[model samples]
Target: MKCVKTQDAVGHVLCHDITQIIKDVKKGTAFRKGHIVTEEDIPVLLSLGKDNLYIWEKTEGILHENEAAEYLRDICMNENMIQSEVKEGKIELIAEIDGLLKIDVDKLRAVNSLGEMMIATRHTNTTVKKGDKLVGTRIIPLLIEQEKMEKAKEVAGDRPILSLIPFKKKKVGIVTTGNEVFYGRIKDTFGPVVAEKVKEFGADVIGQTIVNDDIEKITKAVEEFIEQGADMVLCTGGMSVDPDDKTPGAIKNTGARIVSYGAPVLPGAMMLLAYYEKDGRELPIVGLPGCVMYAKRTVFDLVLPRLMADDMVTSDDLAGLGLGGLCLSCDICTFPNCGFGKGV
Candidate 1:
């Protein structure tokens, strides 16, 4: 690209977008790249403080910003995603469906580490609605060395650095355990709350079993749910360390592999996570704490999306939650969008 006086730019093609900013009124591209500068455009360019303009001048082994951005987009785009038209030398990726957004963090970091270009994205492993902006790609300079973008592709490897995993329609079972609720002293509120949450992810609560504090009965309820073809089982209440809290013990009796009995998160420290395998299928059996019934958001909210997407959670995954696990319980909750349970 060659720089020329704005007054002498007539008939020259713009190498980049000309942005016009008017405090609160507007801030957008006034003239797009490749636009042939006309005599009437000089006053508009000068008003925007553009005394000099870069004219498009194709050169070998050099890439325009728009071309570089497309290469960056290729590194990040994957299934269930769509890219916006290159605007002002930037390309944005949008979600094509409601699903969990997965970012190849290591590769993403490496790509960004290559100076002069970047791929900014929303947090990985989070849920995104259809049409949501997933990532933005652009080069810092209006032009870049083609070799630099080639190096970026090599660092990203063969696979794209981002993906969207659609949530599965699941059949869920709920085991409401507590002597008080089992005896009909109080209505089972936990079941409804858990049911509502699972419904948000398109899961159907096939059944809810009310069991007392008996370990055997609690274990039987969980096993019965699996036998009924439940893809996931949720055992709510009785997750504390108290003598009567048999939910944890019952989950163990089902012979499920316990991923973690505790998580480093508030309002859910006592939660239990396990997977029960049967006939070659491993189904999740989660023991939720009492907080899930009342708290607006907890560890349950963070982990449910992964479960619905069939993404297995490991002990290390739970351990990493310590960084952003605390929930402030604000008067007006904006969970999932907030920092609660967003660690790692």
Candidate 2:
């Protein structure tokens, strides 16, 4: 143990040294200085820590770092903390995973783990058994001084668990109310748009109603739809400051508790949510502002998931929309899957 020369002789049996290295705690400096570095070196390197490891198996496949990070992250960090791939060597991760890592656009050749969003996704329509290897992750190696990883781990608790979404079918009801529609002055375009949106959740429009702007009549129709067992209701138009817009008054008069009479989101800020319950069953009735009819997206985007899940919608729940409540429309209307109020 005293001289480097003595250790080099012991290093001749390299395989034995590797196994013993796991037990030794001395840093790499201790072994590197010795000529016969025994099994003492391996554990130090292993302990030094790495965000990802670029592993190449014997058969030959270009193992990407971020891809490896996805696979390795679940193993290293789970249920807490976060990890991402930062630009190091030369690789821009695949488009979908660009969120998981930060990269130096100039270098697609080296390797690093700077910005990685500790998440990955896989889609399977064919059924998967439990414990299937859904993603692959790896560790990145730079000339890192192993001790730093402790600080990093402290900063990141357990790694985040992959978020999985479960989609389901829903039964919806459409109540289109307006004097213009009832009088045939305007075609009923709102009904079709709302119906199509509900279908995106694999939901069926179980009921549809067209009523003149009479608060009493609209209220009665809502009650009837609930009696007919509609899980969700959408009341289009009649949502603004106009005195004649009676959808809100109608839903409330039907013994339904109003959730939010107006939301803060644009193009649909005037939207309202109502809930009806009698005999231990709950039904959600939403009043769609005119903006939802043509603006492509709005506050309706915020509550649709809960509607599809048959979750209870309360005034308090609607109050929470003030935060992160705006929806931006793009040239593309790729909806139900975009960042527009995914409750980020």
Candidate 3:
């Protein structure tokens, strides 16, 4: 790119966008890239503090800002995502469907460290709606070395940095395990809470059973739900260390492979995760702790979206969540958006 006086230039094409900022009124592009300078446009450009403008001057080994931005976009695109037109040397990726946003943070950081370009994305593994902006890519300068962009592409490798996992509608079975609720000593609140949480992801609660803390009864309830076409089963309560808590044993009794029996997260440390398989089809069976009924957000909130997206939860995955597992319990809960269990 070559710099030319804004007043002297009359026909030179702009190499980059000219931005205008007016206190609280406006802050956007006033002259877009490729806009040919004119006598009338000179005053407007000058008003935006553009005493000299960078006009198009192609260099063999260098790429213009817009071209470099495209390389960044290509490195981050994936299914169920749409790219916006390049504006002011930047492009944004928008979700095409309401789903969970997954970011390859290792790859993202590597790309960003390559220099001269950047890809900024929202928090990974968060829920996003259709048309929500998920990522933005840009070149740091009006012109950049093509070699730098090539290195970024290499760092990104075969996999894109961003993807949207659409939430699949699954038939859920809820097993509320508590002697108090089953014996009519207390009103059942856990069942309703689990059902509402599942509904938020558009999954259907096909059936629900209230079982006593007895391990045999809990095991039977879980098996019955799977037999009744439940793709996933959630057993609430009875997951603590107390002798009366037997939900974890009940889940294991179903012949499900237990992924984890406890988590590092507060308010959910007693959580249990297992996968029961029948006829080659694996079904997830979750043993939720009492915190689900009291805490606004817990490890359940962290793993439910992944389960809804058909992503398996492993012990290693749970182990990696310790860094951000403690919830602040703010006056106004902004879960999923908050850093409760996003360490991995």
Candidate 4:
């Protein structure tokens, strides 16, 4: 591209978009890339504080910003994503379905570190609805060296950096364990909260079983749910180490392989995760902590979406939550949009 004074750019073509800002009124493109600069456009461009303009000049071994953005998009886009048209050297990727957004963090960092181009995405492993913007690809300048983009592609390798795992419609069962609730000494508030949360992700609660703090009864309830074709079982309450809290032991007695008995998170440090193998499938059995009953957001909120998506959670994944695990508990809660559970 070549730079020329706006007055002398009559017959030249614009190589980049010129933005016009009208403060509170409007802010948009005044002259788009590939538009021929007509005599009538000169005054408009000058009015927008454009004394000079960069005109398109075809050159080999170089790419325009919009073209470079496509390369960045190719490195990041995968299945279940819709790519938006390039606008002002930028392209956005949107979710095509309500699902989990997975980003290759290392690859994202590597590409952004290469300079001249960038791919910014939402936090990985978070739930996103259809039509939500997932990532944006931008080229820093009007033109970029083809070699830099090639390096980014090489770093990204064969696999795209971003992917969306569609959420599965799961059949869930809730076991509300507590002597207080089972005997009607107190209302079973935990069961309702878990049910509402499960319903939010399109999972149907097969049933809620209120059982006393008995390991055998809790274990039997979980087994019964599994036998009834429940994809996941949630045991609410009695997760702490108190003598009366038998949810963890009951889950263990169900013969499920325990993934993690505790997490580093504050509100839900006593949470337990296990998987039961039945009929050639591994079904999740989660022992939700007490915080899940009263807290607005807890470790349950972090892992439930993943379970709804059938995404396996490991001990390491739980450990990583330590970094962003503390919920601020703001007056107006904006969960998932906040930094809680957005760990490294």
How many backbone clashes are present in model 3?
A: 0
Which parts of model 4 are misplaced by more than 4 Å? 2-29, 32-54
* Candidate 3: regions farther than 4 A off: 3-54
Q: Write the per-residue lDDT of candidate 3 for residues 1-344, one digit (tens) a residue.
A: 68888887788779767788999899988888866689999888887888998888767988878778898998999999998998666999999998989899999999988777788899887888999999988888777898888888898999898989999999999999887898999999888999999999999999889988789999999999999999899998888888889998989998999999999998799999999998898899999988999889988999999899887778988998899999999999977677888685
Candidate 1 Cα misplacement greater than 4 A, ranges: 3-13, 16-54
Error of 3 at 137 (Å): 1.3
Give me the overall lDDT of model 3.
0.88
* Candidate 4 lDDT by residue in tens digits, 280-322: 9899999999899899999999999999988999999999999
**TM-scores, each model vs. reference:** 0.89, 0.56, 0.89, 0.88
Candidate 2 whole-model C-alpha lDDT, 0 to 1: 0.54
lDDT of 4 at 166: 88
TM-score of 1: 0.89
Give the per-residue Cα lDDT of candidate 1 at 268. Answer: 91
What's model 1's lDDT at 6?
98
Q: Model 1, residue 262: what's the lDDT?
A: 96
Residues forming the 10-long window of minimal summed lDDT in candidate 1: 335-344
CA lDDT of every candidate: 0.91, 0.54, 0.88, 0.91
Which residue pairs in model 4 clash with each other?
none
